[model samples]
Target: MNIRGKLIIIGGAVDKGSFTETDLDKNVSNNLNFFEAGILRRVLVEAKHQEKSRIEVITTASKIPREIGPEYIKALNYLGATNVDVLHIERREQATDPEVLERLKAADVVMFTGGDQLRLTSILGGSLFHDILLDKYQNEDFIYAGTSAGAAAASNNMIYQGSSHEALLKGEVKITSGLGLIDGVIIDTHFVQRGRIGRLFQSVVGNPRTLGIGLGEDTGLLITNNSRMEAIGSGLVILVDGRQIKDTNLTEIELGQPISVNNFAVHVLSKFDTYDLKTHKMHIQSSQYI
Candidate 1:
């Protein structure tokens, strides 16, 4: 059965959304306005493509406010999503409600807000809501959108615990399980700013079965129906293909001598660029590069 209809993995939406500090306190990032604007544009455009007048924003990360807050609801509304249901499915929240499951079954677009990736998986894993999403994504007209931590969960393997600096050092790479929406790829958000190339590279070296993609802040990778991907947003998308690697001299690497590997190819994609996962090649719509 077909599982994922469409998926949009966003790096970091700092401007338009909220962030939780390492200590779990709520801290608003600086670029929420811009983040909201860019995300709204993407949502509206996607909805227009499906010819749907409205989209559904399922907010499962945050607490249950008296009602859907204006900031989030307004963002969806401006993007043409007439109906926004903020489903609070935090770890402390109850398991998937039957009513919410039915609503999710009716949704054409499912958006996961940014927060903590760990919390998101913990709450939704093996729950009825997660099962319903899997079923609908396989059989219905649904598009999944995830920003930041939500984006991290969109992949098969998530980097929940690690910084760029630590990853660059020898024997210091860490990763955790993810939602596995898109196979053959390990996704990392807030890429360039966090200097996550090392961690991504380590993931590839550890598992040559998947490609490593690092998306910069405010950027995204749109995975289409045919498994072809396109880069969007303001920054660049980094693709690391390690399938051809012959040897990874990781065991003997020092702290800062530049980790070495064989046949590890890297590519940078911007807007209008398309990447084919099956063939592992990237190209502009009309231009070619090899």
Candidate 2:
């Protein structure tokens, strides 16, 4: 029961944009080569390693028909996954079942689809399902990956408060409990498109205790086996540092006020770029971000 593996969160925008052969090659160049060469095969190459055969899709927040559709399921099967279990977690009866936990324990990649993140929190909050989610992260047989709201909830601190246009002013945001698979930071998804710079600031200003991370659509951050994180996908992963802020004039902020936020620096990166969470330093690594 070796439970150590990297966690990769792909923000909403999966299967979107110009992810053609050329684009995928350009974007995931090294990873594509690995896939072609069966390099990723070793990650779960053996029958013993192949026991990770389940997928728990939390459709609690978004309608399954709308979020992922049918083609996505077929894609998983095409990838040679023997079992693909769809859990309609929104239904109260299913939500309360203990069997749900067992299914989660058997999953290889536990994917969360995009929807209202607030809805995700409201439904799974304080439930057995939430506990099982945390347990899976601790388990040796699972991998956690979320997109959109799913990506947002992976952080220790959840920024469920404030809108994209609001001021970064003080007390404008709220932090709620997430699954807590990863700690010491907050995640905000749909970063660039939603223009959520202010919201991240509001989150930090409200909490002032954790780091803030805003990931753009179609982009992902993979925390590798070496304990270093690399940005992947089409867009940039935004890192906001608030460790140096002395004070924020959020109290003086109005509804919008252009959402001015100080004491926060933003870092954007493409694939092959790495950022160390332990040392709080950003660097480019020799290794490719596959």
Candidate 3:
């Protein structure tokens, strides 16, 4: 698949506090603050249309849309974004609203906030708004960004319900169709913080052909042209590649029984590390400034 736009998949807990404060600072230099130098800041710069960027923030995934909406607007505004509008489409009926579509049409960057992944797909699936969003993602010079639940819903296959501790058991992980912005991949957020590696592993094993991407909080994966991904942020990004698996007991086990597999490859990457999805290989480099 050839994707023309860029994807900024964040791992949730992006700085929404004081831009000048150092509370959220992880690996950032003293000269660079967290809010102005965090993952979201990198996303804004990568959009490359910041000066004239008309950002449309979709808060449908958030349970507290009103609260999350303004927070993003404030953060973006602090980052020098002049025109950031919050599209509070909470219902399926609101997704096809003319005013909503109009704003989406003119947006240079479309951001989805964190909440429930199911809410986003259920509300916008098969709607005119979704079709337009997918079209823009494939053909326009657009930037598609999502954090947490938003990030999990960006792939063709999404893990809706699952517990990491019970992930090794058959049928423990539940998956459904996502927005299909990117193909052959499944994404999970707040990975390390939430101890979600087992669930991500289950996802990759079930759909062995699909790559699994686990993102840590405050970290992000910048996917360009649907092929290469570059890690950005203070946390780590874990990749589970099951293409080389030699054996598995998935078929023989019952729905609740544990599964066994061998030869599954795992890769851990940090900031500035790059991975080629097509080749299933990674290139790691040490941080230059650190």
Which scores greater on lDDT, model 2 or model 3? 3
* Model 3 score (lDDT): 0.87
lDDT of 1 at 289: 53
How do the predictions measure up, each by TM-score? 0.82, 0.77, 0.92
Task: Compute the lDDT for candidate 1.
Answer: 0.71
Best by TM-score: 3
RMSD of each: 5.6, 5.9, 3.6
TM-score of 2: 0.77
Clashing pairs in 1: 15-31, 15-32, 16-32
Q: Tens digit of lDDT per residue, candidate 1, span 1-290?
A: 34447788888753444332354334333434554436456655665344253355545554543243355665555445666656556443455677677777777777776767877777787788777776766666567888777888887678777667767555577677777677788888889988889888888887887889899987888787637898878788999988789986777877544567888889999876889887777787656553
The 10-residue segment with the lowest total lDDT in model 2: 34-43
In the range 1-290, model 3's lDDT, one tens digit per residue, is: 57888999999987555334557554334424566657768777877587468898899899999877887886777667888889899899988999889899899899999999999999998898999999999998899999998899999999899988898889999999999999999999999999999898889988789999999998989999999999988899999999999999988889999989898889999988999888876888774665
Q: 1-290, model 2: which lDDT tens digit per residue?
A: 23364566765666432233454444433433323223122223322345355655556657663445343454444446566656667755565687886776566666677787778877777678777776656655466667888878876678777766553544556678876777777888888888887777777765566777778876777764324677876677888777777776666666545444456766777766888877878886554663
User: Model 2: which residue pairs collide?
Assistant: 3-140, 12-148, 169-250, 170-250
Determine which window of 10 residues in candidate 1 has minimal summed lDDT: 18-27
Q: Sort every candidate by lDDT, greatest first.
A: 3, 1, 2
